[model samples]
Target: MRLFSQLIALSRSRQLGRQFKEIERCIKALPRQARARLGIQTLREIGQASRMEFPHLYGTAPEARYLPWGQGTEIGYARALSDNPEVALRGIALWLAVAYHETKDCTHAALQAQHRQLLRVVRELKESHRGGDPVQEWMNTGAAA
Candidate 1:
């Protein structure tokens, strides 16, 4: 009975992992800017999903509260600035390739370099995004709408 119970639990956990992979696949199907949007959305959804799965994970312990913000706030804010279209598109391409390589178990230094380059471009674009919103300007003037 103990072995059966453990096997059942393991199988359920595996199924949950597969479900998470499916969610990731859905995000990868979108374009770069779209991926960022969906990435945010998926993260929010996962929070809700986790609460539904294990309510104990929620709520804080008064004894020792760990704020996730810490020193990562500055880094996170910098990354957030790169949420525009051109850089976002490039980021998405890099992300897709990375995800593919990861899923296929074929990670390489060049792939990491490509991803880092996209991140750098996104950071640069974000710094200049306020100067002129070319993506928005072109979209506003384009026919794709």
Candidate 2:
């Protein structure tokens, strides 16, 4: 029984290791700016931010009230984009995934609030991106005006 249990634990560990590797690969695949937007500087930061943002989802706390996801989230994202694009992109991806999942049903009041906040953040980011590069904006609009 002991041997059987040890083998099962080893197999589970291997599976978890593979999953972590895949996640790292996916993070690396993202563009530098995108990664920065995601705020992917360090694993510690990600763990802390995620833990605070979604305590319930992460099984950290019973009451899962997120901090105000407004200007602060946007500022962090923008700063990450300028300072460390890679980290930002990873953080952005994680945030988007969580927001998308939480808002999909649009049933819970808290989730709905967060979904709305996420939309605002996205709009602001889009505007900043467009404003920063006129050439890119022109191309996006299809041909120079």
Candidate 3:
């Protein structure tokens, strides 16, 4: 029984790890600006996925939350991209998968919220990619925009 439990835990970890790697790969393949936009979308998707997947893995549902980054998805993307690309991508991928899973596949609301988060992270990521240039900002300043 102990061995079985250990195996299950290990398997779960591996699965999540694999998912993260996939996301990282996707992120790395993106163009610089696209990477930020993609990261934002990826983050939002991951949040929703995590929420959906939580119940099966943990026997309880988790809530999806938005990252605080506004319209500056690129800033976060650039930051994460600058870090070991593989590591950052994997982490974000895992996050998105977990979020998607936690949400039980019903993520309209979460996705909407994440869309806003994505915009913010992208803008922030853009500036970072630009060496902190204030002029190089994401145009969509407001939440709705």
lDDT of 2 by residue, 78-141 (tens): 4334446445554444444443333545444444555565455445444444354667767778
Residues 1-145 of candidate 3 have per-residue lDDT tens digits of 8677556545544443454355446555666766655455555545553454232232122342232212122222344455575556544533443333433343244343443443454455444354434444445346436
What ranges in model 1 sit over 4 Å off?
46-145
User: Which of the two, 1 or 2, has more TM-score?
Assistant: 2
Using Cα atoms with residue i matched to residue i, what is each candidate's TM-score against the true structure?
Answer: 0.30, 0.33, 0.36
Off by over 4 Å in 3: 46-95, 99-145
Which of the predicted structures, 1 or 3, would earn the higher TM-score when compared with the native? 3
* Candidate 1 root-mean-square deviation in Å: 14.8
Q: Which candidate is the best by TM-score?
A: 3
lDDT of each: 0.38, 0.44, 0.44
**lDDT for each residue of candidate 1 in 27-85, tens digit (9 for 90 to 100):** 34555556455445324433442444222222223332344212221222232336464
- When summed lDDT is taken over every stretch of 10 residues in candidate 2, the lowest stretch is 67-76
RMSD for all candidates, in order, please: 14.8, 16.5, 13.6
Q: Would you list the clashing residue pairs of candidate 1?
A: none
lDDT of 1: 0.38
lDDT, candidate 1, at 10: 55
Could you tell me which 10 consecutive residues in candidate 3 have the lowest summed lDDT? 67-76
